[model samples]
Target chain A: MNAQADLNTTVPVELIDEFLKRIPYVSEGITNVRLLDGAQRVMFDLRPGFENQRDLVASRISEIADKLCLNYRPGSSRVLVKREALPGSYRQDPHAELQQRGDIIAFGRGRYGFGPKLVRLIEFFEQRSREMAASFQADPYNFPALIGADVLDTCRYLKNFPASLNLVSHLREDHSVLQEFSQSVRWDGEQLAYDRNGASGVECLLSPSVCFHWYRWLRDVELKEPRAITALGKCFRYESSNLTGLERLWDFTMREIVFVGPAEYVLASRDRLVDLSARFLDELGMAYEISTATDPFFVDSYAVQAAYQQGFELKFELLAPLPYSGKKLAVGSINYHQDFFGRSFAIQAAGAPAHTGCLGFGYERLALAFLAQHGLDQKQWPAALDAAITASAAHDKA
Target chain B: MTSSPNESIEQRIAGAVMRALKIADPGSSTPLRMGSTPGWDSMGHMMVVMELEKEFNTRFPPYLLPQLVDVEAIAKTLRKPA
Candidate 1:
């Protein structure tokens, strides 16, 4: 059953876009939401079984809407560089092409199994990132997919992004519990039915981003000099109904380079990469923009955190245009954490808590943007990327 | 002790910080930075901001939020003309 309800409360015009973005995640029932009546009201589309919960969803929306600070005016987005599409460039539906060519298989919503072509493209992006990291003398590191929940607590991620957390659990380490779990567990069409009491308490979570592990690794250490580390890892965020296509995934690859040391060193390192990445994108002949951005803090803290992040200009994202939809996707971000991580983890440098920053590139989103802009035909790609892919293919055969 | 009208902006800010963090006053000379101080984590920092805002009867501009990491910084921001 499909149902729609118009929000009675008025949302400020300035916050309408953000308001729309957050509504779908208000509840499991809200499968889709949109603005109406000149952004004065909202319309929510309920999932079949959730039509009865519309009132509860509306109340939650109202609660969040009331707390949203009206003081924030959307900051004039600063476009550091804007590139025009290459001649004869046209947008193609990359998702369909990738599916048709068996380049990707959908395991579930927001999950995919990459075939040779997609895998090669992902590696190509990673190699480019590795080269960028190499220029900064960044040592490559690998991090586990799971992180201690305590580490996230210390990092304040639990408070800010509770909505996105994916906790991990295992069966309790007792003979009786294990026997019960093994005996009772059965897969129904929708989900597994198992003994809930047999499960152990959650101690770890699927890491939300790769850079957090670096901070956890350096905790309580004093740095005599600045250091840079790069890693490519799987990061998870439960984006609720917002999970769609390659653009928004529940689990995605993040290639991150993190710098830690004195404030000046870290800031300068972040600036250098921002410049380098812009040039790299230009070389790939991609039309993109680097603009100020804010994290999607949970709705309760959204207003304050968004304002603070934007006010200080702590984050900037590289947004590539999706031509078919006339929308832009953020393929990368440059973030300055100041002393937040340094202080939280007690990592010191130059007689003070170290400052830290990182640049994260979303590999799948980058590949999708490239395909959408340049078309799926490898021959039509920029010369450098095409050559690199060719060399990579040759390397695999050898 | 409750903050008296005679308290300086620095003292008032310190009081707010102390109240938000739920710690006793460490005297006027001792510095309190966000991470170093007990219970002054990110959430605590926001609490301190709220306390100061209530005490000063002003809403801090968002740009000023990051700079209010210590009592001195909070005092400095509060002293500025609204």
Candidate 2:
């Protein structure tokens, strides 16, 4: 059996919900939120402890789908929002949850969405690796590390405002026709001012990072227990307004594992992710080299940013050639955000602030890289690559 | 799932949810906040409430959907007795 098959056979029911509750904030670092619907609905219901919640949510979804059948195709409807439960309904209706049983690979919010998207990405990267090895069979060159999507962005609002929907209202006040999926939009025009100590309502143009930022009012929130490791989906950038195709997406799934402890322990945890990433690729016969990289967030800063871009390399980006993009796309990164995020969240241990770092893997990017290394057509994929891919799925089901 | 005329306020509640789900990217990990993240523009807010109406199949009163700022608030309004 493959890794996916193994996951299916071993993990008991309710694991997903338990994971969700532990995370607290599925949407970014925002507390108390999660998405409850997507592609794989039925398989999750039949999996293990969640036989109840899976059935309930699935049944509700099925009823809604049947009613809406006259309008749309199956499996395209949005079910429930992630928030507080209804007055009489169970906050977590065990009977209504799905078993989370498909595509061993997890997606957004760690909910339902294991589909062909992931399978295709994996196939593409694997193919690329095989071709590289064949070409280098006679010569010698270092294999590239894989980087997943964790493109970080920073922002400053138009005006000092509370973290609320009012920010959206402010944008609406300026323009009424902007689309719904517009990730970031800014205003222009400079201030007409004279030299003064404090100019009244002075307007200064600010460069905004057109990326996602957290807004939930929270503090001292813990993403994991003192010592827990996990991997899950994370979004990259979204595509165009139409919202079609995987590459065009602004948000993509991320396989992020966080560690908290002393600096040494944290570094050790990061090494584990790197080791696993290389091992996973190596098992499929892909050669790769692990390098060091710094945090993507501090890119625009002064000395540290320049060091990362020019000299002191702490952050590492995995780069491999792709047939689709025709460039070295990043598959993942090993980063050490020592004490930064921990301080921001007020997380502490041993009478001092904790150190935090994450090893992010772009599962889709890895899949894509594999496809580019191997061959796009499944029939043409190398025997070993094919076997490994199938093995992963089988492992999930075991 | 049927509601009465006195429950029109409930329709407004539903309207907000529809607008919330449709406007935001289903794949996003960031919280869906107005004017904070990229897509939550004017039309985005309108779409959120509009989709909410579709979800509940009910029309909301004027200025009803915008009142909701987060999912918890939406659930609170929806669970209230008409």
Task: Give the TM-score comparing model 1 with the true structure, all chains together.
Answer: 0.87
User: Relative to the true structure, how large is the alpha-carbon lDDT of every model?
Assistant: 0.83, 0.39
Per-residue accuracy of model 1 over B30-66 as CA lDDT, tens digit each: 6888877888865577678777877877877666777
lDDT of 2 by residue, A1-398 (tens): 00000111121232232222222111221222233333223222132433344334444433432322222211111111111111121122111122233333333332234365356445445444334323322122221111211211111222211111111111232232234214333333433232222222312221111111121111355434345344343343321222222322334455445556556777766565555556555554432445543222211122123222212133556654544444445676666655544554566656555666555566655654554454344444557656666777677679
DockQ of each: 0.29, 0.01
Give the chain A TM-score for each candidate: 0.94, 0.42
Model 2, which residues run further than 4 Å from truth?
A1-226, A236-249, A294-312, A323-326, A379-385, A388-398, B1-82
DockQ of predicted model 2: 0.01
RMSD of 2: 26.3
> Model 1 over residues A156-206: C-alpha lDDT tens digits?
899988888999999888999988888888988768899888888999999
What TM-score should be assigned to candidate 2?
Answer: 0.37
